[model samples]
Target: MAWTVPGLLAVVLVAALLTAMARGYALRRQLLDQPGERRSHAVATPRGGGIAIVVSQLLAYIGVGVLFPQAAATLAIFSAGLVMVAGIGWWDDHRPLPALPRLGVHVLAGLLLGALVWHWTGEASSAGFSVLLAIALINVWNFMDGIDGLAATQALLASVAYALLLPAPVAGLALILAAGVLGFLPFNFPKARIFMGDVGSGALGYLLAGLVALGLGTRSAPWTILLVPLAAFLVDAGLTLAGRVFRGERWMEAHTQHLYQRWVKSGCSHVMVTSGYALFGVAGIVLMHVFTWLPSPWSHLAALAWAAAAAGLWSVLLNKVHR
Candidate 1:
C-alpha cells in the first residue's frame, strides 16, 4: 500500500471523526471516571474513548479489504476476535462484571486468535507458541495499562515500526490499528482528558499478540529480539505480579503496583514517565532493526540485557521518586 496524499488524508479525517464522537459518547453516557487512590490521574475523565479505536479499525478493515479481497477473511477474523475482548471490557466498564466471567472471555478470545492465526498461516511449530505468546502478551498489556498514553503509545509505535520487521498481511492489519491508537493518544495523555478504560487496553493487548505472532511466523528473528518492543513491560508486570502472588496478595485484584505507577506515585508527572516509555520503545525497535543483520543468536541477548536494564532503571527511579 503506497500511501498517497489522499490515503493519508483519509486516515486522518476518519481518525479525527472517530475520536471526536468517542469523546462525546463517553462523556454523554456518564462513562467518566474519577481519580482514585490507585489511579494516576487527578481529575474526572471520560473513559470509554477506546471505542473509537475499535470503530476506526473496523472501518479501515472494510475499506482495505474491498480493495484487497485476499485479506478480507483475515481481517474479519482479527476484528471479530479483538471485538469480543473489547465488548466484555466495555460491559464491565458500565457494569462491574465478576472476575471469573471476564477471565473466561479473555481466554476464549485468546484461543480464537490463536486458532485463526494457526489456521491461516498453516504453520506447525507456531501453534503452541502462539497460544502461549497470546496469553503472555494479553496479561503484559493489561499490566502495562497503568499510566496515561502508555499502552496506546506503545501500540502506535509497534504498528508503525513493524513495517520494517514484519511481512505484508500482518503489517497492513497492524498499521490500520496503529493509526487508530495514534489518533486516540492525544486525548489520553498528559492531563488525561479521556481513558482507554478496560475496553481499549484489553482489546489492544489481544490484537498486538496476534499480530506479533503472525509477524514472526516464518521470519528468523530470534524470539527474544522480536519481543523488544514490549520486553520492558513484560518483565516489570510479570515479576511484580508474581512477587505479589508469592507475598499472598490477591493477584486478581487491580492495584497500582506497577513500577510506572509507583514512579508516578513517587511524584513524577504522567508526561515525563509516558514520554520515557515512548522513547524506550523507539530505542528498542531501532535496536531490533540494527541487530537483525547480525549472525549470532546473542543479538537477542543484547535486547534482553537492555530490557532488564530499563526495568531496573525505572524501578530505581520510581523508588527515588517515592522517597
Candidate 2:
C-alpha cells in the first residue's frame, strides 16, 4: 500500500521469477507461438508469459486493498474483471475460441469495469463512456499484439505515465503494474523468448482502462489528459481498422498492415519500431502534462492537436515506407 521502493522491487523480482516459471511451463506444455506470414518473429517462441504479469499485478492489488480497506471494493471489481478477461484469453491461447464468445466476455468485463467507475464517480454518463472505451482498448491492444514487445512496452509507458500523473493509491497501482510488465519485458523484447499471448495483452488493456477511469473518477486529470498517453496505440489501431474497412478487407483477419507491422516489413527491426512507438507515448504524456496548464477548453484542443500531429506523422512514415 505504501509503494515503497523496496516493496516495489520485491514485487518486480517476484514477477520476474513467476514469468520465468511460466516460460518453462509454456515450453513444457507446447504452448508455443509459431512464426507465420502475419507474425513478426521468425522462430517459434513460448507464449503466455503475460500470466506472470496478470498474477503479480492481481496480488499487488489485493495487498493494496487489504492495507487500505477503503479501496477494497474498487480492487474487487478490478480483480473480477481481470479474471474474466484473462480466463478467456488463456483459453483462447491454448485452444482457439469463437470470436463471438470472446467478444461476449469482453463486453461483460467492460460493463463490470464501467460499473466500478460509475460507483466511484456517481456519474452515469461517465460509466457509459468508460464501458465503450474499455471495450475498444481491449480489442485494440489485442489487435496490436502481433509483434514482440510492442504491446507490453506500450503498456509499460502508459503505466509509467499514469504513475507520474495520478495520485496516491492509483499511482501506486500504476507503479506496481509497471513493475510487473517490466519483469515480463525481458522475456519478450528485442527477440521474444515468450509471447504475452492474448492473456497478457487483454488483461493489460483492461488494467490500463481501469487506471484511466480511476484517475478520471478522482479528478486527478481530465479524461483527455489520461487518454493522451495512449495516443500511439489508439492512433495505430484506429487508423488500421478504418483502412481495413475502407478497403473492404476482413477487419478481423490477422494481417501485418499495422504501422508497426509495416515498419517491420519495410526492414526495421522490432526494437526500432517499438522504440519509435515508445517515444510517441512519451511525447504524448509530456504534451498532456503541459496542456494541463492551459484553460480547460484550450487544453482539450491541445490534446486533439497533439493527437492529430501524431496521426499525421504516422501517416507520413507509412507513406514514405510504402513508397
Candidate 3:
C-alpha cells in the first residue's frame, strides 16, 4: 500500500487516459456546458470529464484496501459515499434536477460520510458537525467550479497538502486523489476541452471532506489546520452567500459574484485566477505546517494572524472588482 514512484506514475497515466476517453465520450453525447451570463467560458465545452478522476481514485482505494485488508471496512464506507454523491451528480448533469432533491441527496451522502468518520474516531458528536461540513463543502465546491481548471487545481493542491499531513492509509488515498486531479487538469487548464460537470465537482468536495475528517480522527494537530488550506474557497463562498442574503437576492441562484468569478470578470484569464488561488492554497499549507511546530499559545496566535491576513486579502481583492 506504500505509494512508490512507480505506483504514482501508473495511477496518473491511467487517470489521464481515462479522462481523455471520457472527454471523447462527452463530446459524442453532446454533454456540453454552454456560454451564459453566469458562466465564465465563452464557447461550449464537453463536461462530465471528472468521471475519470472519480473512477481512478475509487479503483486506487479498492486496490489499496485489498492489499491491506485491515483498511477494507473504512475504504468500503468511503467508496459507498463517493458512489452515492457521484451517481446523484451524474444524474443531475444529464437531466436537471430540482434544487431540493439534489440538496437532499447531498445531505444523505454527507450523513454516510459522517458515519464513516464516526466509526473511525468513535466520537458520535463529531458526526453531526462532519455531516454539515461535508454538505457545505460539496455545495461550495460546486459554486466555485464556474471557471476552467479552478476546482481541479484547488483539489489537487489540497489533496497533496493532506497527503503530507496525514498518516499512511489516509495519506495514500490523498496521494491517489491528487494524482487523479492532476490527470484531469491537462484537459481543463488554460483552455477547456471538457468540464468536470456536477458529478466531478460534488464528488471532489465529498472526497476532501472525508480526508479532513480522517485527518482529524488520526492526527493530533489543532483543528485549525483542517480549515487553513480551505480558507480561500470558504471565505469567497461564505461571504458571497451572506452578501446575497443581505441584499435580498436569491443566494442559491447561480451568479458571478465569487471573488474568483469577479476576478475573471475583471479581465483576468482563467489560468491567471486559478494560479492565484493555487498560490493561496500553498500559503495556507505552509502556514499550517509552521503552526504545528510552534508552542500551543503561539500556534493559536499564528492561526488568528493568518485568519486576519486572509480576510484583509479578500477585502482587497473584492475592492479590485467593479460590481
Candidate 1, 1-323: lDDT as tens digits: 56533554566567667767877888889887777997777878888777778777777878878888987887787778778888988898788888888888787777777776578568655666676777677667767877788888888887676656886655766677777787787788765677887788887887777767666664637667777777667877887888799999998787888878887887888888888878888888898788777777678668778778877876786567667
Clashing pairs for predicted structure model 2, backbone only = none
Instruction: Return the TM-score for each candidate structure.
Output: 0.91, 0.97, 0.96
Q: lDDT of all predictions, in order shown?
A: 0.76, 0.88, 0.86
Q: CA lDDT of 25 in candidate 3?
A: 91
Q: How do all the candidates rank in terms of TM-score, highest first?
A: 2, 3, 1
Winning model by lDDT: 2
The best candidate in terms of TM-score: 2
- lDDT, model 1, position 297: 62
Give the residue spans of candidate 1 off by over 4 A: 2-5, 120-125, 218-220
Clashes of 2: 0
Candidate ordering by lDDT (highest first): 2, 3, 1
Worst lDDT 10-window in candidate 1: 1-10
User: Distance from true position, residue 112, model 2, in Å?
Assistant: 0.8
At residue 152, candidate 1 shows an lDDT of 84
Write one digit per residue (lDDT tens) for candidate 3, span 1-323.
Answer: 44556677778888899989989998888898999998888999998988888998888887888878998888888788888888888998899888899899889989997887788778886787789888998898999998988999889988888888888756877888898898889999878898999999999999999888877788646667677778888888888899899999998888999999899999999989999999999999888888888888888788778877888898888997865
Identify the runs in model 2 with alpha carbons over 4 angstroms from their true place.
1-3
